[model samples]
Target chain A: MPQTHDDVAETTPARADVVEMVGLHGFVQLAAFARLATDAEHAPDLRAQVTISRMAAGELAALDQLETVARRVGADLYEAMASYSTVLADFDRRTPPGDWWERVVRTYVAYGVLADLQRVLSRAVAPDGRPMLDDVIADSGYEDFVVAMLGPVVAADQQLSARLALWGRRVVGEALGIAQRLLAEHPLLWSFADRQDGARSEGDDAAWLRKQLSGGHARRMGRLGLTA
Target chain B: MPQTHDDVAETTPARADVVEMVGLHGFVQLAAFARLATDAEHAPDLRAQVTISRMAAGELAALDQLETVARRVGADLYEAMASYSTVLADFDRRTPPGDWWERVVRTYVAYGVLADLQRVLSRAVAPDGRPMLDDVIADSGYEDFVVAMLGPVVAADQQLSARLALWGRRVVGEALGIAQRLLAEHPLLWSFADRQDGARSEGDDAAWLRKQLSGGHARRMGRLGLTA
Candidate 1:
């Protein structure tokens, strides 16, 4: 059994493990965001989004020998990374954007939804892993930035809010579409998700994920000062 | 008036400065590469090049924070980074590749030359900066990977070398093409480039850059086991 973060309250695993895991996840997430940013041609205001994402990616590789260990653990962390990667790849392949705001909105939809899911999932990992996950979540400034960006646009134009709300809904829909496929195809990750609730049935985890997404959608809408 | 790395010897300032400059440069370089990786259709082995480039980008971002501080002390340093970044952005925009090998050759031609230039330029920076530059250069791992990927293709099909040679020539042409525009537009960078040779003219720098490109082209050809 992996030691939970709460278990070693006094001394952390020398801070190195936290650094390593956080760094790896950070890299994966950032690269995912960078891919989204490319598609966010409509969101020129969010060009910095990709830059931040790339920074996250670089951090993962910088974790000394931790990256090697992450791979060796058979966690398939890299594969897990590539799995999420397809979300962005699909976005790139199907719809290369012509406008800036569309690009930003797409990014806001894709990365924002994924980040929220990871934020919650990180909590279910083992204790030692929890700290690392916490660190990863902590470093991701995407949530705050997205909310900030959405605030003004919604405040100025109610139509923008409505359109973005619909966009957000579609984003979640597409994301869930992908998640369902991933769950079916990747039994280990599905098992991991199932173990999050100590439930034997995957249905329990699926229900839990649905509730989280609904809540997330509500929070995102509120952030935009819109009605979901 | 800037402190040379040698002047600082093996003391903290020397090491700290070297690391800082290199770290920032690395960060910018990685970010630039990630942007390029998104254009992987232009590369020969899309998946591998993208993976390597993304890894390099992430590693650059994860360097110690102390290093970031050291590199930001002078506007000159930032300016050099910005100049390189501009070159990258232009390359990205003008010649977005539709094929994989073209992208690989572009990476080889672009980063390969920049790495070589960095190797030489690091010597001119303060002695404290050299080690950090060296560290980044060592960690990049791109050159070896590129050579390995290029080797098999070259040995089995001489046409691969010929095509890549042509591609390499185009990258240099585009890079120098942009450099000329930058020289005309950014007098500050041009002046700095001249100062490197103790009052060499801007024209002199252009001449030197051409010579550097010529030599790099030859080296790349040799690595591909081709006659230049």
Candidate 2:
């Protein structure tokens, strides 16, 4: 993990890069927590929040612990997390809560997009390192939870399908907007995208992301008793 | 795990109690996220947060997934997680940011105390149910991380020793503050506390908590290069 380039970088250290990355992870972790907190609110009662909080706390602790390990392993852990976070934070900061549908769409679409990207990125890691990445991906029970939550509501009301479908489109638009920012900032990640099998063109990654979003939205809408 | 109560008072459904417990878990999870976010700020560079976030996310997801399983198994997962979260959240929401020492101390002492309690409570469950409790308790890596974080900080800064010791005391006060609220809200938890080690009185439970806090604080302080 301790490559010569990393050692040289540590010595001459682009301080601004370091700061930016830390800021990014901070923003992203905050967004993650906010999402968790908001989701917990939908729980049946305060007890549910407590339960969710403990789970969330453990996450926080694990993040800190992993950062410590990354430091030992000579990788810039903060920068990696921050790269993702910066995009998310900016999105949240720009998009004020418009309505419940908007919020729900954001959760479903935004996370779904990120998770797809992560799933791809996780594959790039060495085989041994994949376990941790898999673990992170595994914990995103949000999709299932969202489906369960919406199932009842959708069953009761048919009109929600049309409304959410529109909301899903807007959510996809916002996601693509942020993703462009992410690509511009992270050359390594962009390079990885370029190296992908079918993503040889400049806008290929964006197109692929859109396709994923479309597919995910369609699946979720149908699950919620909606027509895409 | 659902006990049939012949007495009418015991049989009455306690919705409020359930809510309070769940809320507590939410609080703890939020605080944990906050603390992790803050700790991420101390990372040497940006990439560190990425690693940390991955770890944190995994831990959080695990906790949440486990709770979902507990819910399926009729173990009131929300209530259990909430009980822990309530104390943590109250501490986070009320505590000033200047109290960094106290924050670390609380992480060290508070988690250890809870883990010990979990160890005892794990026994109360029947053999079939004990494994899940054991898995949750076992997966908590707080002690290792705390030791790692505090070891160098304490060794390098002598002034931090006295400051952290006092901070440890304050953390206990904060814990007690939330503990009282929890006890008032959840008689089941209190009863669980009392039944542990055949203790029957509230005073006894308080004493046990105090002793645990003091010992945990001492151990953590020692790790932080302080004289316990």
Candidate 3:
């Protein structure tokens, strides 16, 4: 157990499950980037469209690093990601975005939750994997670009601002539901995080995670001048 | 007009049409890149998928330089591209891809012809704009990647090989038809290309361009061990 709240405090011996966890994270990245690229097609202006596309390229560049991590661990990158494709895709199919605005909101909100989950999983990884996971999650790089781009656009139109706020709230609801379901499916990943939080019981840790997820969204929405 | 076979022999003073021509080329690059990113979604395997996505990123990178060219000429990039959007989209809507293979083939063949057309227009740009156009056309950087990635895959399956070759033929036909229509609609662009070829009549120049396009495809198909 960690004497202090630091991922490096515990030398958790990573096993096969770490490979699957990383693979799922890699796939999540692929989905996020692909969505950005697709949404660029519908952007209202050329600058907006091209900027979004370039941001997507940045996201894909990060995916390349995740792949590098998989290779270092001797995991077949494709096999690592293949299993989680359905559950992730199903989450999307179940709560399909109605339009470009809804889609963007979903990605923004859900990625925040997903990144939090990945962070929880990070402490459970062997120290070698932690740095890679840390770099990937610190995806604060593009999150800033997205927020900057969206903030002014959303501020410019009162009706659009209101609609996005509502859409964002709905997205958080769907994301919360999906996260709960994901924990049930990925028990090994959950167990890793659970073990890392030895100070708290399983229920306590789960509740804390849910709080982090929602709390993160509320803060992000607030930043965008919207309520979660 | 050039006294020799070079684009820079005479300073053909570029005017408003230069902006529109560059804008159309930018839009074409955008379409080509967007198509790559989309086709990546249906790639047969993970390596193929990730590689295609990265290649799309490369194509997008090339677009950034085109935008730079747009800015240099004081072209409102969005408005410059807007008028031609309908015609471009119409060509796409009329000949939508049946599957991933068809879509890839369309981008490959159509892009070759489009690149050839742009090179002709590149000769017409003011010497300052010509270098940007040249760099963007030399987008041979990723074109080689597509051929390398695709060649082995096509060669592996006899049926796929035959289908792709036939599909390539169909794409060239559609592309040639589109190219002819595009010339009729944008007389200013064609006139520049016409004047650049001082020795050839307009009909002869058009015939030579078509030969270059098809000839390019035939050789590419040969490299892939498929009949163009």
Q: How well is candidate 1 docked (DockQ)?
A: 0.17
Residue A72 of model 1 has an lDDT of 37
Q: Highest lDDT: give the candidate number.
A: 3
Q: Considering every candidate listed, which one attains the maximal DockQ? A: 3
Return the top candidate by TM-score.
3
Fraction of true contacts retained by every candidate, in order, equals: 0.14, 0.24, 0.59
Model 3 DockQ vs. reference: 0.56
**Model 1 Cα lDDT, one tens digit per residue, B27-61:** 34554446454543233332453456464454434
Residue clash pairs of candidate 3: none
Candidate 2 — what's its lDDT?
0.51
Q: How does residue A173 of candidate 2 score in lDDT? A: 70
Q: Which stretches of candidate 3 lie over 4 Å from their true place?
A: A1-14, A124-134, A138-163, A191-202, B1-14, B124-134, B138-160, B191-196, B199-202
TM-scores of the candidates in the order shown: 0.68, 0.60, 0.82
- Candidate 1 residues lying further than 4 Å off, grouped into runs, are A1-33, A36-88, A91-98, A119-139, A194-205, B1-31, B39-90, B93-98, B115-139, B194-205
Model 3 lDDT tens row, A1-228:
111213342334235676767776777777766777888887777777777787777776556566655666667777888866666666677667777667777777887777777776665445565443545654635567667877887878899889888888777877877777766667666645634336356677668778868888888887777767
Against the unseen true structure, what C-alpha lDDT does each candidate score? 0.51, 0.51, 0.69
Across B97-197, the per-residue lDDT of candidate 3 in tens digits comes to 88876777777778777877776666544556543355565463556766787788887899998988888887788888777767666766654563344
